[model samples]
Target: MMRALCLTGDPVADKLLTDDPFALLTGMLLDQQFAMELAFAGPQKIATRMDGFSITKIAESDIEEFVELCVTKPAIHRYGGSMGRRVHELALHVVENYDGDTEGIWTAGRPKPDGPEVLKRLKALPGFGEQKAKIFLALLGKQRGVQPKGWREAAGAYGDRGSRRSIADVIDAKTLVEVRAFKKAAKAAAKAG
Candidate 1:
C-alpha cells in the first residue's frame, strides 16, 4: 500500500513532511472540494506569489485578496460564490487561535490528539462533515500520531454511507523495499552496460 501510494503521484498518499504543521492543515482544508491535482497546485502557486505562503501570511492577507485568488488565478477549489468568504473564515480561525503562525497552530493542536478525538475536533470546523473529517484524519495520521481509521472499517462504513472516500488497508511496506532494490539494480546494470 505504501508502494502503491508512492507510485501514484497522489500527494496525499505521499508521506508529507512539514516543519510547519499549519501549512499541512491549511493545505488539507483546501483539498476538501478541490480535485487532488488542482488542490496540489494551489499551495505551490500561492507560495510562488508570496515568496512563501505560510499560515501567517495567509492569515494576515486581506480576505478580499484571498477571495480574489481563490476565485480567479490558479483557482483550485470551486466554492461557488462562497469560496472567498469560507476561506476567510478558515484563515481567521487559524489566526485567532494560532497567532497567524503555522508552527504555533500545529503545536497548539499538537502533542497530537488521539485519532478519534482529532477527527471530532476537525469535524467541529465549519465546512467539514464526516467524510472530509475522515480524510484529514487519515492524511495527517499517516504523518503524525493519528492513525487512519482502521481501513476495513472505514471502507465498509463509508461505502454504506455512499461515501467516495477510500481509506487504505494493508500498506505493503515490503513491496516498497523490493521495488527500490529492483530499481537500484536496474540502474547499476544500465550503468555497467
Candidate 2:
C-alpha cells in the first residue's frame, strides 16, 4: 500500500487513491488541462457519481451517460466529455489487456521488470503521453515504492529524489507549491525558448 498521498488536500480522496490502483491510474490520467489537486480528486468524484470505481463497470458504462457524469457539478476534468471518454477507454484497455488489474501495467511482465517496459505500457494507455508516462513511472518509484530495475534511468530527471518538477516529488502542501512553481518556471522557459 502507498500509505499516504498528498495529491489532493482532502484526506479521504487521497486515501482512496492510496488504497486503489485504479484510482491512482485514473487520477494520473486526469492530470491535464486542470489543476493538479482537481485532477487527483477526479477518481473520487467519479466513484461517487458512478457508485463504484470498478474498471469493468466504467468500461461498460454508456458513453453519453458517462460523459454526462463527468460533466456534472464538480466535473471530472476541464474537458469532461472528452476526458470521460478517455477514462472509459482507459478502463476498457485495462480490462481487455490486463484483466482488470491496473497494477499489472506497472508490475506484470518479465520476471525482473525493466523500467522501459513499464514506460512502454504506460505510454500505450489512453491519455498517457511520453512525459506523463515518465512522470508516472517516477511517481511509482518515488512515492509508491514500485521501483522495477532501471526505473530512475527510465524516468530521467523526474526520478531525481529531491526535484520539485512534478507530482512524483509532491509529498506535502509545501512540495506541492514548489512543484507548481517549478512547472511555472519551466513553462516560462519553454515560452522564452
Candidate 3:
C-alpha cells in the first residue's frame, strides 16, 4: 500500500516521495538547510526537470548540468549548488552500493534487516549522521512500516508512538505544526543545555 504523505503541500510532489523509495531517500538527504516540505518536494522537482527519477539517470547526469537544473526557478534547496552535488553523489552511492535499488537498503535482502543494521546502513550514506539516520529509521517504522526488530530502540525518541516530534508524525497540517513546535523546543533545549 502506498502511504499518503502530506509533508509537501503539493499533492503531486508528496505523491512522488510516497510512491518511490529512492525519492523518499533523496528527500531525506535534502532535508538539511531547508524546510521539511521543500526538502521532500525536491525529488519531484528533479523528476520534472529530468523527466524521471531513475537512480541510473541521476548518477550518470553531468554534475554541472544537474546543478543548473537544481538551481532553476524554485530551486531544489536553499543552497542549490552544494545540495545538487550531494544529491548527485547520493545517486551514485546508491547505484554503486545498493545496485540502484534503494529498497534493498531496508528490505529482506539486508543481512540483518533489523533496526541497528538499518541505522548503520543509513549512517553510512552520504549526508547522514547519527541523528539523521536514527530519524529516518524512525520515519520508516512509524510511517513507511519498515519496522525491523528493535526498530523502536534504534530510532530512539522518534520511535515513540503518538509523538508529534518529527516528519514521521506528520499526517496533516495540524501535525506539521506540532512537529515544527517540537523541533523548536528541542532546538531551544539544545542551545540552553
Residues 1-193, model 1: lDDT tens digits: 1232331244432333233455445455665454443443455555555676566667787877776766675464666236546655766776786566543422345355444555556676656677766655554444344343443244234223223233212124443345346546866999999
Clashing pairs in 3: none
TM-score list, all predictions: 0.59, 0.97, 0.95
Cα error of candidate 3 at position 97, Å: 0.9
The global Cα lDDT (0 to 1) of model 1 is 0.50
Q: Highest TM-score, which number?
A: 2
lDDT for model 2 comes to 0.90
Residue range 14-120, candidate 2, lDDT tens digits: 98898898999999999987899899999999999889777888999998899899999878988888999999999999999999999998878668568989999
Query: lDDT per residue, candidate 3, 1-193, as tens digits?
Result: 2367788889998888788998999988999868998999999999999998878999999999999999998999999889999999999998999899998888746265888989988999998899888889988898887899999999999899899887878878889999999999999999999
Score candidate 1 by TM-score against the native. Answer: 0.59
Worst 10-residue lDDT window for candidate 2 reads: 105-114
Q: What C-alpha lDDT, on a 0 to 100 scale, does residue 116 get in candidate 1?
A: 59
What is the descending TM-score order? 2, 3, 1
Residue 89, candidate 2: alpha-carbon lDDT:
93
lDDT of 3: 0.88
- What shift in Å separates residue 115 of candidate 3 from its native position after superposition? 0.6
Clash count for each candidate, listed in order shown: 1, 0, 0
